[model samples]
Target chain A: MAKILIVDDSRTSRRMLRAILEEMGHEVVAEAVNGEDGFVKYKELNPDLVTLDITMPVLDGIQALSLIKKHDPEAKAVMITAAGQRDKMIKAVKYGAAEFITKPYEKEVVEKILKEVLAL
Target chain B: MIANIIANYLINKGKISLDQYYEFFEELSKVRAKLGLIAVHEGLMTEYQADTVNMLQATMDMKFGDLAVEKGFLTHNQVQELLRKQADPYLSVAQVLENMGIMRLNDLDLLMKKYQVENEMSSSSIEALKSDEIDRIVPLFLPPEADEYVAFATLAFKTLMRCADNNIFPIKGFFAEKLDCQNGALQFVDGDPCLTAGMCGDGNALLGAACKFGQEEFESVNMDALDAIAELLNCICGLYASELSQKRITMELYPPQYDDTIEGVGEYKTLIFPMMLGDKLVNLLICIGEKLEFRYS
Candidate 1:
């Protein structure tokens, strides 16, 4: 089971991701409200996987992802987005985000994506 | 929604007693049948066919008539005919009233005429409302500038019916400077001109939607309830954004935010679409080109 960190402004999204990850036998080690806090948490926890939300108040997922990758090039980060964020998704991919998940998360799809990312 | 509106109008106009209205609604509920069942009864499709369509409906998000047509069990025209034969809620109430000898057919007709006149509804608009077609009825309530958002409102209402509450109906929408509510969820869409959409209601209405969305019972509109509602709003905004993107409009969806103590007036111009979900009242607030601010009461 992989150690995961969830970074999103939405409490609901974090709670839901935690539930899904825990149900799949993965450990959710930490959570952050936005990209800025997320970067600090990533450095402190050094989790195996990180999920970052794109649109946020203090800092955004892409900027945080870039910073994390700069700190550790092998950082496995998955970008979370709502639909119609294709442009941001492309940017995240270019910045070394390992995977993507959309909002109103589907359990099976999320599990499959997480398994794939963790396996890598 | 139409039935409730008509019933309220009748009660207010002294055309029907409140007790009689309740009794009439009770009878109307019993007699009102689904389009699939009506199709079967009208001999347009076999019972097996109707059952097959219903089963497909359970597994798929498509409507019964659309699935039936796709499966070659009924034509588009036949589906329309079946839908016409299905007892409309307004007509069902009127028939119950007539059957109970509480109001004659002529009196019911007169009341309907008065309703249209007082409501300033054209015959076709009244027919559309009676048919309970959200697409047709939504535009009638929107201002000319806000008419562009009718598609979004229609999709929202349809999603509510499919996922949250099937018995909901919309009230007339109006343009306002601000809408004050106790609890609500809001999300912003970034694009050429940003749009803000949110749903707000009192604790009861918020709880009602949250319970339906979460499929869990909640005592009040707490964080969990607000989360469920915010998630629902997120879904709606995502879909709306996707629709806009298809038309070559680039939009970005922000995570949904919820505020429980939101009250007071805002400076942004908003279109307030009020709807009734079961017994609860909820409002969808839309603002285009400006950020929304709330004032607490």
Candidate 2:
């Protein structure tokens, strides 16, 4: 089981992630609405993993990922993207994002990638 | 669309074997409605006139409509009307079934007449509906075996109305093989119960949904506007997936496809629910059990 933080601008996304994580026996330590809030939550929660949506009103995912990595190089992070955001995936990788999950994501794939990141 | 109805009836009556049924649609898939036939069908021209125009095109380098216009057999407006009718799936299916000798044209017409009469129920039901009563309107458009999708479709209509246009309204849904539109977005869910959903429109029809949901005034429907449309689909898919997940039916979204000139081809029947958004029309299409080949664009 892992301690996870989900940060997304969409309420739907936050709730869905929380449900999936809880069902998988992992604990969702916190949920944040955007990247700036996500960064603040990471500092406070010190969770095992964080999932950040790539776009948000304040301090988008890539920017927040940079801050989280600088704060903890070993942080396990997954970046959520919609289509046409493939170009940004390369940038997220450079910023040390562990994996990428696109929207309308399948459960098996998301679980596999997140587990792989946790194992690392 | 009529083909499926007749096909199902034939199966239930044991008029055709299962193998024959599959073979019929296999042949039906090869059928494409031609302009000359449609012109004759619409009584805009005679069989003799269409034949003459086809022969003239062999000696000249012009489109059928253009040559027909040159020959004064059809006006330019009439040709444009024929071109639009060329995409009609009903005509294609009827032509194929007639050529295959499976059913007589007269019998097919009678079946269609009966189908249309039964279908008047939904249209007459619509007349009783008050404006702002979309909840009562949504179910009338869904196809059979769509109970799971009722809430999904309802939320989609509500979201588009609240976030994009206040006065958007959906017409009755019908089956079509394909839809041609200027631009749009679509996403799919793959799980125990698969699903496909999409929206598209021509010209400035989609501009309202794009700008209002995006919260940006796009002068025209551009890439930025399309991206916003994709995001809106993602948002809807996310909500739907969550609801289904609670039922122990896990669902996940495939990437949303969007761009200029989306062409969707449904493997089965594609149900299109037309909506009046702004001054133009936008289409909402949903298919169950299989991915439309983009199995739709």
How many residue pairs clash per model?
4, 5
Candidate 1 lDDT tens digits, B100-124: 7777444766877887898787999
TM-score versus the correct structure, for each prediction: 0.74, 0.45
**What 10-residue stretch in candidate 2 chain B is worst by lDDT?**
B123-132
- Which candidate comes out best when scored by DockQ? 1
Give me candidate 1's TM-score against the actual structure: 0.74
Instruction: Give the Å error, residue B223, model 2.
Output: 1.8
- The prediction achieving the highest lDDT against the true structure is 1
| Best-performing candidate as measured by TM-score | 1
Fnat for candidate 1 (0 to 1):
0.52
Stretches off by above 4 angstroms in model 2 are: A1-51, A54-120, B1-128, B143-149, B295-297
lDDT of 2 by residue, B167-271 (tens): 565656676767777677777767776878887877667888877776568888776677677678776776676666566666656656677655544566567
Question: Which pairs in model 1 have colliding backbones?
Answer: B263-B295, B263-B296, B264-B295, B264-B296
Q: How close is candidate 2 to the true structure, as a TM-score?
A: 0.45
